[model samples]
Target: MTVLKGARERWVRTGGTELCVAELGDPGRPVVVLVHGYPDSKEVWSEVAVRLADRFHVVLYDVRGHGRSSAPRPLRGGFTLEKLTDDFLAVVDAVSPDRPVHLVGHDWGSVQSWEFVTVERTKGRIASFTSMSGPSLDHFGHWINKRLTRPTPRRVGQLLGQGAKSWYVYLLHTPALPELAWRGPLGKRWPAILRRVEDVPGDGYPTSSLPSDAANGAWLYRDNVRTRLRRPRPDAHAHVPVQLITPLGDKFLSERLYDELEQWVPRLTRRTLSAKHWVPRTRPDRIASWITEFVTAVEVTGEPEPRATGRHAERFGGQLVLVTGAGSGIGRATAFAFAEAGARVIAVDRDPESAASTAGTARLIGAPEAWAETVDVSDEREMEKLAAKVHAEYGVLDVLVNNAGVGLSGSFFDTTSDDWRRVLDVNLWGVIHGCRLFGGRMAERGQGGHIVNTASAAAFQPSRVLPAYSTSKAAVLMLSACLRAELAGQGIGVTAICPGLVNTNITATATFVGVDAAEERRRQKRATRAYGLRNYPPEKVADAILRAVARNEAVVPVTPEARGAHALSRFAPRALRALARLQPPV
Candidate 1:
């Protein structure tokens, strides 16, 4: 029985081996062939294949000697690149006989697919290629040669860095050790090790065939590595459009490996994920999305559109980012920032029209896709429903910004219990709800994500005049800190953004306690004018939010005053308290 439910299985005999192949999706749709890496089988692509099965004809085949496939007679020289290419050709010929297939590969699968896409025999057979966690051995050979021949300080350092990363490769080539380890203790412990180190979820992965698969797969390194590195093919240039996805946290590979990749593939698109290796299992949603997008573009326009060149495009492109209170001010600006970086924006606001406007503007700003969601963050049921809807439709969020907030101004004595509840509900509980709902999904996905909570300088600077607002923001700040510590182990980052007096419409909407309607309006106008004079745009705060996520910063103070107040609160509490005690100009 096949491990993938609903999959149609077949066997293709090639190079004296029977390759176990699984096909999913409609047969008439565009064909997408996913190839697995060493010591792994077709099951690695199960998560990704199922996601892509909706729009494309998805196919996954175990490389010879892995999964249910038959092992070569002699382990030595049985898994050469030439034979692997033959296996791929046979599979495609049998499954996608009428048309060329789009190829996606990870790890050693990518290494071999590089050979398939570049070799003259497979030129017209492959329509496009997407590679992750592996570099073409020919390209890798040139990279090594260039650094060795040049011998510059920077080049030497890069060579050493990559050499250190390839420590496992050396072990794989050792005669009997690898096979013994895999058959005895190594294969048994690999699943656990992956869960502990890579945060890869345990869900029927590393199938029972792992011990024999790993032991037999050792011949792949023996047959290819040394010979290719010593004498790489000079004509190793891709014949099809290529998409490269680099995992920033991949322990086994260096990003610098693809520096001169454009020379090998004329048409290229580059994307980076803040993930480790084995993304097929850990980040199936993201992988499926990119693959679908690339394949569709190629099928429609004959080539992918020029990719976004915005700052952090590599990091944010195709990622899903959700921002609450995105109708205006800091929330809207934050949504636009992620859009500019090529993320898919989910603009959530209480006002339906406002949310729609933000989503539309986000699309104009370069988001591949933008959506509007209307929900009152203060309403627990509404937030829960929105969370479920988002997960059902859009998959897990890559970034969540809990920027919805309300402003309140009053002394402790003047502030009503209702006033404090209103402020806390939006400012503090809103963040809590977003973290609990969306952040829980991110944790369960086991792929790391970031959460940004909008706090304020008032959080640390105690102000008698702004008791309700300050207390709410202070609670948010502490909550973010505590959550940061709690989720750090899960690879989730929590950031608190504190902006001082941003020139936005928050002031115009702020409520004033112990004041009549007319006086409240008057105070609101004065506060708006004061903030306008300060002229700290929410755009700057949005930029700070992005930077904080990139750097995984715990707390960020956006404005000069914010920074000053934050420093003073830490180093000179007495001075900060004195300033806070002074009567506000408003």
Candidate 2:
């Protein structure tokens, strides 16, 4: 656990706009960028960042006009995604230039993360990403997933909520009124205005003791959201592996909103927390542990070959377990879990530190052996090397878990060609590599091995929202089933884990349009809260995988909701389709 020691805080200028910057941990280590929700400042992540400083270089910033950052007179809708992305990238330039950064976002920040995950070029620029309570813009586009109960009351409340939460925008469209309000009428009514939109936890914040009886961060909401909503979704994003965290207790967004998040980044991993919308602040330790586990896992997948047995009939004690993107998230968790299960873990990841940490942790946990190594799951040569290395060391793989993946969450239009290709690379092609390289050997040797591929409940639930991601997961599910059919004859078991929400970091790795990472997260949080969602534990899913392997089951739905979705997908396809649409936008 990270103790609440001292953390560095600063107000810095990137462009013309200024931002509140809070940094902790060794600057040389990987940077974890933290973005807060609306009406909150960088201060919200203060205690959390200090704790995270123990393992990583944590960076938290208040969006322009929020927190301690200055609000230039007549603040431009400068909070837009492009501007915000630039601000984030600029932070990277200012702080950690040589190394890629890791991102952690909640609410509006998730939206920006959505954009971050879609571009191929940007893929090399980031190590990993996590989103909490954010929706993909293309998925969240104005399709209106609302169900208003009371006609008159609902209508009035909706209008006022929109206006109150977003008053600064209309104020910005015609800056004069906002200026007057900030200087006059609005100042007096700020209390009621702030209360209408942003929630201040009773136990948190000293603002409750202030006479003003309101928050100053509303400007962030008005300026950022109003601007993002106006622009068309961005055409592409830097394709980086992503993790999304959906809080089941969030009252702002619905679970259904994530029905097709994979369509956004195809290589997505979904994790839903049992907590409310305030994950970064409220559950920072858990969040940090999850990321640390994930990044460490990614690093461990790249280890060197251990000492080999001279000549054994079957060296099951040290078998090869090739896991893609093994440096982080489920892959990391799965890798660690497998090592603990008595298999020599071959942790594969693009990041060296993450891979190393994963292997290190697994070894520390008393795993007989663990190896961390880097390899692009999509690369034929890389995967082939993985196969050859395993073949030479252990002679045969007892288990192969294709758990490495990425998240795509933007709309079809917002995603670029690069986005599509990257999704195929890690999500589809990565699996293709694993199956072709690992499965072929298992078939040739006439020995059985369990292959478990991670897919989302979205696989069975058709989603056009995140077209690319959904399509890829669907392909994975299909491929897994098909491979199961062929390999079962050889006594090989293939299982597809269709998890609903397991409360991981996939949201941070999502890509969407228009909004920067922060704004996107806000919308996602809002939409999740508006609807009800349920999340499960990754350990439970891991247990399911182990059971599936032992039983040679075809499919494993990790959550109760997932089990229901799985049944509906087969027995009542129409009802499943209908239910999927009920979710808020991605």
User: TM-score: which candidate is best?
Assistant: 1
Q: What lDDT does the true structure give each of the candidates? A: 0.93, 0.65
Clashing residue pairs in all predictions, respectively, total 0, 100
- What does each candidate score in C-alpha RMSD? 2.1, 23.3
| CA lDDT for candidate 2 | 0.65
Write candidate 1's Cα lDDT for 400-489 as tens digits: 999999999878889888988899999999999999999999998877899999999999989879888999999999999999999998
TM-score of every candidate: 0.95, 0.44
Q: Give the TM-score of candidate 2.
A: 0.44
lDDT tens readout by residue for model 2, 1-586? 2222366777667768777677888887777888876545565566567767878888887666665565545554555566667777777777778877777777777776666665443555677777778775545543122223234665545545544543444544553454454546655554454333332232334222122211333344455554444453545332555666666556666655666566555444455444456666555544665566555544455211232221210122234466666776677777766666555777878888989898888776545678887888888897788678878875566678887777777667888899899887888888878888888887765435678888888788766566788888889999999999998655577999888766665665566654687888876665444423444456677667766765568988878777888898889999977765654553
Q: Tally clashes: model 1.
A: 0
